[model samples]
Target: MPDGYSRSSRRLSILQCVLFCALTGGLAASGIVYDYSRTQELARQRLEHTTDLIAQWIIGAFHASDYLLRDLSGLVDTEILQHPHPDPQAQRRLTERLIEKKDSLPHAFLVGAFDRNCIVTHTNAIVGFDASERSYCRALRDDPSAEVFVTPAYVNNLDRINVTQARRLESEMGDFRGMVAIGVDLDFFSAWLDRIDVGRAGSVTIVDSAGLLLARKPMLPEELGQRVVEPRFLEAFASEDEFSAIAGPSPIDGVVRLFGIRQVPDLPFVVVVGEASRELFSDWFWRAVVSTGMIVLLWLLSVLFLRNHLLLVRQRSQLVRVAHFDPLTGIFNRRHFEHLADLAFKHARRAAVPLSLLLLDLDHFKPINDQHGHATGDRALLAFVEASLSVLRETDLFSRWGGDEFVILIEGDEADARILAQRLRAAWARIELRNDQGAPLSLTASIGIAGTHPAVPGELDSLEKLLAQADAALYREKQANR
Candidate 1:
């Protein structure tokens, strides 16, 4: 109801609004961060599963190739094949067997038998092909302990990239006698991988243990057979984990991706599946944007509601003040004074205590207004109210009863009321008032006292009777003063 109380309430409301917005914003940010982490975790799991599938497929292919090479090695006789010019009938028989075995395996392109000189002795395809410079041929010729070998990807005579899997051939006396080998077309992996989807900017790559790029889908022709030198790739290759995931920029294209790497079982090959980060988290990005917008919008609405609520409270407080107080003197009005007086009268009667009333009339107020104008008269009234308030006790109720007339209700008897009335007169006489013409003015008031005594019976039973007695007393005082 007071200005200070209203201001404090407004400040409290503002503080509450600020705290609410801050808490909401903090929660929204935390939720967005949690969603981002969850998205990344899910993507990592998916890529790891994909790499596992690719590694198993490669293992199956290598297992089939290894079985075919080993079986073919057992059928060939290295001692008889090493002869410079052996029987043509024996060579013809071996070539027919090689063609029959090679046809049974789907992935094997060429199946051949080589002698001690690393020279092809019999073949399923063209003859007289020398494998002396090939890694698998050289390994078998140089190392008697080497039973099986898988070579790195290399360009073959047909200008197509191929990886060879081979088994060492030995004489009955356990002598090194070159090897039996099969060529696996790298296109076999590429063709199968093309059928699988890995997103828009994704890739599937196969590399040898020596870090040589064997094959890749979303292929780069220039990168084939080249060594991969990226540090993350090398780390994954050297790690003990059979399958692991890592994130980094691609060395070939510089696009960032999450990569899942796996080593094929019992083979010198690694499979890597990469998913582009942008494509993987596209949905999450949009969700974050929408979530943030909603949080901000809700906070704004809450603030607006709080502002409107506080404004309404302030307006209601002002209306209450206008209804209960005098605008000119900032004191209680006649109607509010009457209500408080009735309550006081009832309480005093019930408690058997004395209740007193003092009515004041400004003397010669109309003459002052007619001579100096109504503006001076209003100033006189305000000054009188200010002076009276200074003299009155806080427990006393004072009001402007009418124009140039005021009333007060005190808790004491007429004797005590007279003492307060004398003080009011002294304070009012000291007031200095002026008109617009800068002329000094004098103001005075006549007081009337009335009360209900506990010792008296029905002397002042109602407020109307008390007021009538106070008015008659005021008239007698005024006549005596004249």
Candidate 2:
């Protein structure tokens, strides 16, 4: 191949390698992005599922409290509750019933009957406890039609945080009589939640419609019964969506988390399941690191392999050039010339065309080398080759046969060969070489021509025969010149 073509091929290979690596990196980046998005989507799904479950559990707990309070309200005697101080025997009978009913509900802290004045008339726990200041009592009094009320979390007289579910008691005339109330211990939900596998920094929380934290696993004691003020949580609560997933820093603890919030159906509460951002993406982060490392490692290895491949190609190309061309004159050497000439001769013979060979010897070449140094002699030889190349057609095969000797295979007959030989002689005559002293030296050559015509087959049958005839002619021409 030509040097220019070889160089272009190498450049194209490098460009292709660069594009391949770029494409690989692009694919890797896209995969990582997809994985990251998938991780977040999966986390949201899991949180939503967990929130739904917790919401259902809370609903079940509320329903149990509501049912117990409603049942006890029917059993309490309105006549005994009407008096500020009731009959001791009737009140004792009522207290025993309250204790029995409260035992049936596992998480119920207290089950009691209240009079119109919000005075505890019958109780499972403390007697004569006043509950008029409680939110549930006040709510039932203000809204006479409110049959059931659920209050925000508050510290009970027992100093435990609890929420109360109460059923309003009515007289036969539809007048407000009193209420039967049950206090639900927040610890009941917290204990169950603690068994769940929320991650290292994850939490399960229960909040009322007013954003009052009722209960939480991974509990913040100071935050219980306090209103949550996180904007994202408030926004989710205010939204029309019954269930939503949100991400932000928690107002209570300042830890960033992905929160799945679900409003408990028909209950004045919401269940929030929060997964810490760091924990949620912890596995993905390591996968990204390992995947990126592998991609980079593969890219570097590919580049190195391509570099070695290109180097090998370059070295092989150089070896081919050295094997096929003359080191000094940049023309075909005798072995390569003969191989090409043999093919040409065979084609010419088959086609009944003419082929010619010209052998040239540089005259007085030794004397010039003896006087001006081999370097000048080499310059003369290069000049001769350049001159010959200028006069020859591309179809002609010109080569350095040996020292001071050159050969050319022409595609034409003897007459065409003679005309080209004259041109070669004239071109060589025009070349001027300078010795070290800057003295001009003229160059000349003796040319001998031999040819074969298809009409005269016996004259030249092969390249070897043709070369021998051309050598004889060259010897005669040199002797005549001497």
Candidate 3:
């Protein structure tokens, strides 16, 4: 309706909007995928990070046992024992050294070689020699290369306590000398495990090589000394590279567990197990699902709202144009011409500037309506509107005042305004049209310009005053031309 553009332009615009909205579905799906991928990567990284911290802690604790044991060697060999024989003074010194290490180490008892003579109930109890009859002691006494032997958790004659580390005292020739073993109390891990807050269902379990449960948080007192490796251990221990797996339901515990494993190389028989529930995954996954659903719903509502808004904008533009513009010439009618001038006057007053208004009326305009016809006059008006607009910049407003009369409002630049007025006069001189009877018509517009001059402030009372000034100028110019 505005610029003689074809019907195809409107259809293309509507199609493009529809196509753009259609692509949003794919965009939302991509967002969901991106979120899920990020969640997985983050979870993996956090799992590895947690495993590393715990593994290091276990290694540090294991080495701490070794540190305490090194002090025992100094006392038992040098200060305490009368070499090759047990003495009462030797027992006192060994007991003193063991006592010193008690506060520093979690495991703080001594086991000595149970010689037949030294095996009596109360003569002198060595730290390592709890029982000479067991397979654990045999491993220490017989294996010549086993200078250090950490035993599996067993039902001990002394209250069935589980020990993580044990050391042997043999001669330099790799003899199976009597052993000095300490039962590392599981209670020491209680404080450290509590400090690491890995969540409610998440726990840390340290088991020996024989799979005897060493220590764990929220520990099952009945499950102590029970083996972790099972007919279903494969489910838990997925791969050496796979640090974690969802273990199938335990026949022992009857609950499903996701287990993360870290091999502790420092301690001979230690595997650190991080276990959590399958329900934890469901809890997090459902949150993401609900979040995604809400997001999609919002996006749908947004598309609907934008479509409606765009349609409303197009309708408002059409209504405003129809109400303000003449049907024959695509420029403002007499009513809107006055409205534009009034708006400029208000703006000038608000800004405290001098106002100028221009009113242009074509010379010999009605004569063409007579000599050729009203059709020629109509064409002349259309051509005049086009010629005027061609010379106007965005800041300049051009509108048909009525009949063959037109108006222009120029702002901010007087030099540019003068240039546009000159250009408009030249264009009007070139305009030609044919009447309904096919007679030729030639035209020139009597031009006027109206605007505010920057230097003069608040000079005019109204935009009508400025228009009157431009009309007087137009009448004078037209009379001189006649």
Candidate 4:
């Protein structure tokens, strides 16, 4: 009769959805984690390849400068070695050549040759200054195999951060003449690194073998010449020249990143490329949002569809129950009772079994309803049905036939039916109901039997005939009570 699901049915639907949502949420979380991990791995591989290419470019650039420096040193050695000491014009030409080389190699920070006395030419300002005390010059002047020496980053006489690249010049007799040194500005390398894309939070760094910072893409001036003491960096620093990749929190910005390190061969610095953890997984955020949203959306749809199905099932069951049962007393209603009784009549006729029908009517029911209320009459009716059910056998069918009337069908003869009706009458008297004022209300029932033991055949042929007989008996009983 109702359009919506009943209270009990609604509660069952909600409980089912809650359990389903929990399972769906767990599955969605697992899927997101798996996707996140796979995406992160792919990003790392891309970053590693990127860093590799950048490292090669940096190494090539530094190597180009080294080759030029070595070539310049050789040219100088060829000039002064053949002549013992070059003439003034020859030395001037050598100075001119050095100036030309400097102009041709734009990457060179400073290009000028210094003599054994530590005096630099072509610079003009420091032409007569002592050069032997300079660390790079001293190293070349003392070490025999110091064909090429790269100094750690340091502040030069000009107060600029730079690293010295030098190659020793020798005489034809294999005696050391001097060294040709070039100071490379650390900023130049940082600028070159800046040209590439390392993402918003990414970075590239160059540090000497001693762990001293040489250049960094996100140039932190204070970090220049500072030792990298972070455990991850220290670990990379202590690693062999084969170059290894690592992952951890960065010491520079304190952000986590995946790091790839490669050393420039024949150079004193290592190239370290870092891809920030956030940037590497940047795309995964939106992917996870959309993916999780879709999962949740689907789950919600399933719940809605399933709830609709449950509502339909409950509605159907409610309709069937409403069709067959008395709403107030929860007993079989008149129409359904007659249908069941018709089936029972046929079964009993075929089996030739003893069949009994008892029709019951409550006595003085109209006066109680007029005095107390219809609500009390309903309570009395329900109390009678409950008490009768307790006294009836499981095989007996008891049904509410109409207002103030009921019927019972059992597999028994007239005597047995009479005994059952007497028992029900006595029990029904003891059953009581509370009125609105909390006063106890009791009632009695008049019952009539339809079948007598060893009755003639065809006497109770149909349910209608049996019911007519029971109704006559019930009228007689009511008159007797009056």
Candidate 5:
């Protein structure tokens, strides 16, 4: 009878061991899956953020060149064209201005109606072979409406280097005059892109009008002047959306990456990319390694515990939150703002037109924080962001640029934007609120708007110059109110 009792007890113990083992395995799988899923989400978001930034920056760069060309077109006179072409001295003067104003852009080429072929001018010391005999020149010649042309990234035999930003030239008679090209150093832009927080082995590329590779980061010379994408990128490019993604091993690195794409709508190119690093589940991935080692000897059930409970839900949530929206206002954050801005900037530039960047600040609102409380201040900001969103076009960008400042990128010309701004100001005036003392409170906002002068060329397409002017105006307006 005692033997029988011992046998039954042993059987029960074995059953418990089996169940515990299964549970441990489940928990560990959960953690791994949770880590993987969250990491994937983070990767998606990081790629999206990167796509947006590059798209906007590239868009600005192209638009800057466009404004420069359009302004130059206005500068051309029948007097200049009557000579049948630009003299060497006039050409030198124009080249210097292109370099001086657009340091990122180091060269300019023009093919005028009076010339048999396109003439090139550059800031660099690569002399001779003034014409691109490539298909870009032929394409420009064939397309009559190709008013402002950008050729694909091409390897120039003259300099043994790649030309990054190249546009077309038109005659006073609006003939398929000549192709104007700019030689932008790929090294400079590659270095600039590296400064962004994209993980190891990320790439940023500029393709030309014919869909040929121009500049690539992490330096893919083998892929240079080659067509890399499988037409998926061009399909995405055809749409107005600024951002897109594909999930596959990159042709360059062979690493499985969430590759992102942002089209330079102003140009025929798109920025291709991939991001590095995976998100941490709990900052204890390695700790598990050691703990598993300890458990191997003890035959502990730690594995079962981990596998069941710690998987996908937490990681996915964390990554999605970080990637998609702003932490402060619970709104679409700067990352997303840039994504939308790139799209808007492209459309504006494509039409060979102008756009506006509006900077807005709450008037004397800092005192409200001191007078009331941070809690009240937060509410005011919430209300303010919400109200301003109402006044913007669907294509416009609205973002809280930290603290009391906000920025809006309007998809319209300056005059139309100012009209919208005035309307927003009136909305701000209508808001009524209660302070900490439960007393009625009120405030006004000062807005600064910056727009490109239609006649003047712009070397940099950024809000800084405009914001500076707007802030100055705001100071005067603030002074008047006082």
Candidate 6:
């Protein structure tokens, strides 16, 4: 019932609303962080899987090449090598044999064989050029057990980047005869890679086991034969099987890329396939934006719903208070006090316990309002109500009966009612208020008490008779004071 309590309640309600908003925002932020982290992990896994598929495709091409080279090698063993003391006709037969097979081996740009004495046979180029000095010839010569040899990227006699796959030839006595070499134009790989889908700015590369550049899409002539010394490949080299990486500054083009690397089976080569990071994560960007937007919307909805519910509850509480209590003094208003009286009177009549009432009036409330302003008058009324409450028991009903007057219904005898009224008067006398000029103002009240005991009262049989006696006594008290 104090002057500032209602304002304090409003402040508390606002504080609760603020805390609710903060808790909702914090939960939304935590969810977004978790979702984004999960998305990034999934994207990286997708990129790694894509890299593996590209590596496998290139490896499959090499597997096909192996079949072609083996078929040519078999022709040499059965036809020329098995013949003892072979003549020029047999050598010519070997060259004709390669010419026939070359059409079927579409990937091979040139197919040829060289005799043990460094003499060439069945070749498309000049026949007199000794091939024994080439890398493929040395590999077969130095390692008799070597099944195949793969050359690094180099400019062939045709002035194009090419590599070779070779196999050793042996006589029926297992004597070293010569080697069969299949020259492959690496542009075949470039053309194949161009047809495959690897997203925007994606590439496939072939490198020797030494990390030497062999071939790549978006081909660079100056980059051929250069060693790939980037950390990503160096790390991959440590792995014997296929692996992948999200790396920076590609050796071929210096663009950041996601890479997949694997050793070519049964060959001295590695293949690296990659896509640019910008293109690879493009989908993730839109997905992240959409997810964040949904989360924010949900957060806002929760806050709005909570605030609306709280406001509804607050409105209900305010309506209940306004219905039951005096707005200014926060005591029971006349209608609510009368409603409670009907119940209290019925119970009292049944119990036969004595009941009492005190009707009090402020001596000069109207003069105070006229002299000082309505604002100060309102403060004075609030102070008087507070002091009266401090003197009354919880069971007693104190109410604003009308302007500048109040009533207290006591659940006791006449003596108890008089004692409570005296305490209320003394307590109110101590209350202080200030006018607009800030001067202290004092107060007093006149009170009349009535009891249910008919033996001592003029008339007190029913509620109406009891109120009449109280009013009559109050008039007499006012006359005596005048």
lDDT of each: 0.83, 0.85, 0.61, 0.77, 0.61, 0.74
lDDT over C-alpha atoms for residue 117 of model 2: 78
Candidate 6: residue 83 lDDT (0-100)? 20
lDDT string, candidate 2, 1-482, tens digits: 44665688789888888998898889988988999899999989998888888877777777777888878987986667844454788788888888899888887878888888788888766767888888888889778779999876777888877778888888887777888988877675675586567888988888887888877878788878889987778878777788998888877787899888998887778888889999998998999999899988988998898888788878877887788789899899889998998889778868878899999999899999998999999999999999999999999999999999999998888899999999998998889888999999999999889998744636677888888989999989888877
**TM-score (all chains, Cα) for each model:** 0.74, 0.76, 0.47, 0.71, 0.45, 0.69
Query: Compared with the true structure, what per-residue lDDT tens digits does model 6 show for residues 11-66?
Result: 66667666766676676667666765675566457656655565667667666777
**Number of clashes recorded per candidate:** 0, 0, 11, 1, 18, 1
By TM-score, who's the top model here?
Answer: 2
**Which digits, one per residue and each the tens of the lDDT, describe model 4 over residues 297-363?**
9887978887787768777877877998888988788888888877877677677777899998888
- Candidate number of the best lDDT: 2
Alpha carbon lDDT at 205, candidate 2: 89
Q: Per TM-score, what order, best first?
A: 2, 1, 4, 6, 3, 5
Against the hidden true structure, what lDDT does model 5 obtain?
A: 0.61
User: What stretches of model 6 exceed 4 Å from their correct place?
Assistant: 1-64, 71-146, 151-162, 171-178, 241-263, 275-277, 280-284, 287-291, 294-321, 340-357, 366-379, 390-396, 409-419, 433-441, 450-482
lDDT of 4 at 66: 79
Where does candidate 4 have its weakest 10-residue lDDT segment?
77-86
Model 4 whole-model lDDT (C-alpha atoms)? 0.77
- TM-score-wise, the better of 2 and 4 is 2
Greater TM-score among 1 and 5 belongs to 1
lDDT of 1 by residue, 227-299 (tens): 8999889888888899898888987778899888898877778888888989977998999999999998999
- Error (Å) of candidate 1 at residue 112 is 5.8
Report each candidate's C-alpha RMSD, comma-separated, in the order given: 5.2, 5.0, 13.1, 5.9, 43.0, 6.1
Better of 2 and 5 by lDDT: 2
C-alpha lDDT of residue 394 in model 6: 84
